[model samples]
Target chain A: MAKKEWEKRIAFLGPEGTFTELATKELFPNDWTIPFKSIPECIEAVDAGQVDLAVVPVENALEGSVPLTIDYLFHEADLFISAEVLTPIEQNLMVHKNNVEKYEEIESVYSHPHALAQCHKYLYYHFKSVPLSQSSSTAAAAQFVAENPELCVAAIANVAAAEQYDLQIVQKNIHDFHFNHTRFFVLSKRNDRIERDEDKQQIKTTLMIKLPSDRSGALHQVLSVFAWRQINLSKIESRPLKTGLGDYFFIVELLEDENAPLMRGAMEELRTLGCSVKSLGSYYTYHQK
Target chain B: MAKKEWEKRIAFLGPEGTFTELATKELFPNDWTIPFKSIPECIEAVDAGQVDLAVVPVENALEGSVPLTIDYLFHEADLFISAEVLTPIEQNLMVHKNNVEKYEEIESVYSHPHALAQCHKYLYYHFKSVPLSQSSSTAAAAQFVAENPELCVAAIANVAAAEQYDLQIVQKNIHDFHFNHTRFFVLSKRNDRIERDEDKQQIKTTLMIKLPSDRSGALHQVLSVFAWRQINLSKIESRPLKTGLGDYFFIVELLEDENAPLMRGAMEELRTLGCSVKSLGSYYTYHQK
Candidate 1:
């Protein structure tokens, strides 16, 4: 079979039916999509030129940052963020369709650790005695339950997973918090400027910063440049530099475009203070309603 | 057995033979230590006055902060950190004594997700085909391997775990990072000032700060208060406030005594700026050789 000329290839973190896949489908409806088992694999596909773009979850409202995606982007890949997608996360309790009537008899529950933790209160209240197990992902748990009919297990995943794996939803929206959402990044090898949709798109620039090791207030100095310019920062996260303990490089995301003069000035000032600054990308964000 | 007047009870995150246990033993050599299955349980036990103090790992050099410990302290428990213990981590590969000769035939490896991740390169290079499973803790994995000798499973744990479970060490120091260290906090119900050990002890004050939501450069201003006074921050980590996405509270550790005039001035300035500041504790840190 030959692919159509207009159909672009996209890769997402999945075994299928994961939130990343849902975000991919929403973003690239007509594109040919492929599923990679892990975040690194998804990013590698784009870096290897196997796919035109890759979509992976970078942060969850409740779970915080996904270290793998952040670390890979900072340390390994030369990828750029083409766009950001915000998807609402709804975790559900699902069981195999064949065992729908026996949902109460489930002896074990399975989910990705984050998903399990998000629904900790619910699980503790309802299934306190059931043995909880960790799966590589929520979709993997659903797939496992789909394949093993004799094992009375329930998986905490999204509604898509339940439908894809032929599982019945025993409970819906079981996550502890209502404000659950995950931010996914659309990664590409090229640093092409994203086309902005007026009134809907907002520009964001993410910078990886390393401060001078000996400085007493290096981080404070770095933030001052942006502070004086009134550049609003959406987030600032510190990741280990991997050299040793107490050594870190920060990831700062500013609500400004890459070409903004203020941002450029901040970068210049930071560099003057012996700080290493790398621009991850300046991309437009899309909210999935 | 009834406890003696001089002996105090302490709770740790463990089923026994964990790195936390090793840290507990070093910090309180004569205390009666109890092992709880999880971090929350250990902290809760202390909060309920079941133990004199609780020892829990707060941060690791390689893996970053232990969120459970941080979140529990910030949200649930009204406990204060009495002391900090820095322990070097050494992960090893162990198996049942009966399976020593059949090490090559091992079908699966089990360990805590962090331990398994720490030894990722080693496992990928040597036991690429072996299925890696997650256990509640590294010690729990060792105990499982010990009890199930017929199952050719290996556990990545500490040397203490191997000895406690009577397992054979197939490989030693398999962790990828040599500078691996875990910071454990000795938590107590009362905010008792720790006696300084003079030369070896360094006083650290940890503050939990929540910025007024509407302020633009609130974090920058908060840092400026410390920056101008030259208060060295050992670490600054942000955990979700859990009210919504983008809402966060910072856990800042400063290298100064709690009652320092500069510290008091900074706290007062922050409070005047409408920022809520809570002192988690001011404690002395001990390094275990």
Candidate 2:
């Protein structure tokens, strides 16, 4: 295989072991992966020429679209979605190996609040009446369990976090959903001119739209344009306009390109509906090897 | 003042000085407010009869909606929204009094990822080059800064956290949006029955609907019911169904109770559109005294 370009540093939201970090590694293998503090910072870094690209989670299979990601896109119209990747999620119940006995006598489970919530059913099924210890994140929870070996405590985290902390996996894949995956968008300050192969399948474009009011059929009027053109819409969501007076905004993903005639017609119809829409970007989904 | 008859025990998601704790206390005065690791656990305690009520965030004025709150509601359908409270979100940049000189030569700012993002403009305008350190929550970040006073570090957190940690406020109200407020839902397992008074200004109900397919005007057909009845919709969001093939699920909120004759007529018309609709509950908004 030919060598890939490596000067492009891919920035992500993280501190060593967040799911974003894992997704970064999976997406750009050769590029340098640097973790920023927040999604806006990551996007700003890309905007200010500090980094070549950034990757952030747009939506989750179990939870929904991340509001931060949506708001950042709607507010700052500079960043664009270059590509999309989905990462499968797996959560583990972990404890320090030194306290193997404590596992059997576990009185409470400690984890990042979200991790604990995701695996709530499993914990309740096993330890029906035990108290839960909530930590900031899985890594912190694992670190806590690692230090407090004398206590009967368990942590729910990813297996990678467990390995990094030198903890043993007490249980595995404890999330309520079987196929939990997080959808991530790869963003770059300069769009990479990657040529599409003949085998490229489905195409999707995401846009943010602000309607006149919360009037009924307003959204329908916007969707009908795509319907008339026979273009399928993959997703539609409403977010607060943040302009006060109970105004609303919508983010939509259409299975068509910006230049497509049908999409152009849809934009015209959306304008007549008195909706202000901005195109985020169009990209093809990447399949895992 | 006469004391209320029900001495409900309420559990909130927090350590001690989290904003959630503050909101919970304000929502239920003269009642017990216990701290829990997570919302799910807190809600579970209420379900198990250990606590009489729980407080969880449903949305934020600036950040849109909290996905975990929505997903938890979908999973735990038995609980109903008893009341909704809006708390103004004011984030402070806090640090040890002795660390003032170090801030000029500071290396990093520690805080929850959300806090960091909300105050992004301030960070970029002033401490743009400094690294950001992500902790689990703002309270945890404050605690970390308190314990390591010698380090050239600061934290973004609420005023209560700063007070509890004995840290001085370096900056105040550093949020990107001045009207930042989080809307919390007071949940109860008792019953949905509530004595309505004419004094109550507005009541909102949330619904999740799964559409038939990706056909043209699919959503329009569903929304026409509300348009015909002139019912106002507060919010609507769509998430992937995660069934491998491209399918989506939509969540909607109405500004009125669907049980009322006019609203019920609108809902009946919506059901005729042939879709799966799930009701969350009708709740009265909490006004500050």
Candidate 3:
């Protein structure tokens, strides 16, 4: 209940129509939210007390971990995840209201490269011979297509963005995978820990660590503590330590109770491994829609 | 000997005027080249025999790996890397040649989202009070800025793109990292690998694999082969196997010699791990003016 003691102003990466805005809204409905232009800024705001909490996109199913978000989380201190949100995304095929051509006559497809990528299958099947132009974002693409009547291009954007651009939807749900969800974490400056909630089935603690150099079986030795304790790992990703090419930093999510016997044993073993370790925070994912 | 072989058709990701186009010209000087809209299509062209070779972006110092390119390499068959190029990147902020003001006075700033991300520092410093917009590519962003002269907007683009759009460089070298370089790989359906010349100093091989399930020490155990062989890993990443969460498909890169004894032993031990393994190819990066 420390959350109530704090005002809990949540900060996120955004400009209102961005996906991070959507993710942040999904987590804290009533909390005051501020938008930052970059992940580092969001983290900095949390650290500097400009905001009480921060939400950052960590990974996407198709694109892997967002590297900048990973880097900031790895280096940031005095901040920990207060909660998490998994958002299932549906990107639309958006075009300007002025365009009045059938899908077959469309000459080009425009979107942010990532949006273009997410809709690769649809473009390949329908517009295999047509040109695909990259815009800065789906919203920008729509704005571009709005002005370039000569381009006859459609952009892959969100329904909200389509509405914002007054664009029509030519097609929808074009991503290759049906379950396209992004995992986001809410960060807090305060060190208040999460109380175990019985309603949630999957409990995950997200952490970052650096292992010793010139060592063999170092990571294995770290993992064994968890496996022996019967704790399951939800995810593990390694980033360059940023010190050099050969060095690395790892982010892991453990699926176990913080106070569980096996988990405590695992943490002890991890500390014994003699590496720089920091607990980002623990949160649960609720499968119920 | 392949270098002396007649001629080869190379595919690159471009419509011309892209960083990929510039890198392609460097890799294949005056060779018959076909440009594809995306990296996947370029690889598909090589796989489908439409072209003998293709070039794709591998990793960026600022953005880490291009996940689709790696995932595509993981799934590609009968292909090998012939060479690589690391191009230094310099991002520029541009606007319509007409209006000028601090970024705060502007309503929007356009660029490829990646470009936006690279110049995020500058944008945050200047445009935190304004709106930031993203287009599909830097070129598109420049073009958007060119057309929207009446709107107080700017874009993060490249010098070449600024020239193409007839926009002025509002700022240059806006990326947070000064040593930003994107590594590109030249791939071929033919097996003619590069013979190390005096210019070559180091070699890297791209590898894809699946780690055994619930095996505590599996990845560490597998890495031992490389460590024992003194092989330095260049990169390692994991994508979900897509069977479900908790399962992963991993991609790794490490140094290699065509006939090194330790390298051979490492490959053998890696095979014994009972995982899906694919080698993209081996190549070296050399300095270029």
Candidate 4:
């Protein structure tokens, strides 16, 4: 197990207790895990062959898409999505246990911006005028609360973060909605390098396509190719082409067989209609264990 | 002049010198300008009849979208787009200027996350590993740099902020792209109170539509209604409905007349096709003066 695990080195955006790390542990429990400071760094590690895969959050429920991850995947990194992991984002108000009853005495709280935004209502009603500080990640916020004995400072992080840092969760499941979750993509140098046996559950293919900006019904035509073939779409969203306002590329996710030949035909048809398509990857989704 | 100005009170997300404030000044040059802390707070002020209009950024070239502002306008705030302001996002690296020659002496820098993101390349190359901190706004970061003169710190803000806080601009226009700009929506409580005169130069109609999730070919049908009408879309993007995964609301912008009867027909058609449509607003785009 040790020898096999040594070869399957996975990199994730982390410092431990992060959602990415938590998701990584669920999917690759026996594999070796390394932590990278940023999403770019994590993907770059995988691209450079320093690690076998990179797991990073692609989108969240309330916060919309994770721009840095999507942008890096699109323009910066030359990696493909090997697999995807969906994790329930449960943020908690964690504090040092020594001052457990000091809710009234708490002066400020810390969290990542998206976490803070997700738990906005809870923070507003409970903390009121309490100043909220931002950290790079939720685990970093938890680490701050753990390292500092400051009773007035608390952190909005996950249950794992509380346990990892030995902090007490003052409030549990503080996110605004119960359905809040984040989707993460596991990245690798090559799409088919991983064995297809274990991940035979279901495949979802993601593609980025540039639609003819000025053409009327361009998006409809792009979708018509799928709709006519009875291909069901799980998700579709557009992002700016970065050249100017109003110009965009569509990112669509299709829950289909990994090697569906229909997708290739669709791409060819789209190109004939002056659309450019790039397949992000074809992979299966993993839920938290 | 003062009497007219006093009657036209405007609220913007601010600690002063934010892009919202700058855009507000550009459009409402003579109007009384007030500052609110959060996006919701600013919009709420407009909804509660506290201000005439609220100026908040809805999207940026690099950031993709400001989900909070868009979501609030969609679900929470009963506001309409009175005007749209486009501002060039010029991020400047500012410092106290006491230690003139000591680049290594700069210990930390502060800015809003988006501001920091806009200047990512510059920060990475120049600051190296210098700690980057987050504040509520770019101007608030400038204020932090101004107040904490003893600390070896810099800030990523705008020229207006640097002047407002009396900080020295160490480097200007640090953002990676030259065409980086944010689109600000002037939110108003009364949807049709503002006259269609000065804003009549151009009209861009924005709408939010909910497509029946389980129905096959639902979105393709929605686009067909507009496509056949020769109604071209300027921008289109999907955001999570936040109820569950795979549930989303499409926000589409069309370049047409403010009172185009074709839109009414399109809305009726969309409703028949099982889509709930809500008009965000119609207004002209504001460019940097």
Query: RMSD, each candidate, Å?
Result: 2.5, 6.3, 6.9, 3.4
Poorest 10 consecutive residues of model 3 chain A by lDDT? A191-200
Give candidate 1's error at residue B64 in angstroms.
1.0
lDDT comparing candidate 3 with the true structure: 0.72
lDDT of 1 by residue, B1-289 (tens): 6787998899998988999999998877887999998899999999999999999999888777888899889989898989988998899999999999999789999999999999999999999989999998999999999999989999999988999999999999999888889999999999875564652577899999999985899999999999999899888888888877778889998988778999999999999999999997789887776
lDDT of 3 by residue, B1-289 (tens): 2443567788887655467756777756767867688888999998999888888887776556687787777655567888888777788877777775654477788777777777778878877766777676777777777877888888887777778778888777888767677778888876566554766768777777787666765666667667656677766677766544456777777777634778767777777886557666677774434
Q: How many residue pairs clash in each candidate?
A: 0, 0, 9, 0
**Candidate 4 residue lDDT tens string, A1-289:** 3556356899999989999989998888878888899888998898889988899999887667877887777778777888888899889998988768885578889999888988899988988899999998999999998898855799999988999999999888988888888888889888763444655566788888888757877888899998888787888888877887666788888877536788777778888999888787788777775
* Ranking, DockQ, top scorer first: 1, 4, 2, 3
- Give candidate 1 misplaced runs (Cα > 4 Å): A95-110, A120-134, A148-154, A168-171, A196-199, B98-108, B124-131, B151-153, B196-199
The docking quality of candidate 3, as DockQ, is: 0.19
| TM-score of every prediction relative to native | 0.93, 0.73, 0.71, 0.89
Predicted model with the maximum lDDT:
1
- Residue-level lDDT tens digits of model 2 in A44-106: 888888888888878777666777788877777477788787777778878889776567678
lDDT per residue, candidate 1, A87-197, as tens digits? 888999999888899898899999999899889999999999999999989999999999999998999999889989999999999999888889999999998655746
Overlapping backbone residue pairs in candidate 3 total 9
Across B22-69, the per-residue lDDT of candidate 2 in tens digits comes to 687776667877888887887788888888888887787766777667
Docking class of 2: acceptable
Error of 1 at B289 (Å): 1.5
lDDT over C-alpha atoms for residue A276 of model 2: 85
Q: Give model 1's TM-score versus the native structure.
A: 0.93
Which predicted model would earn the best TM-score? 1
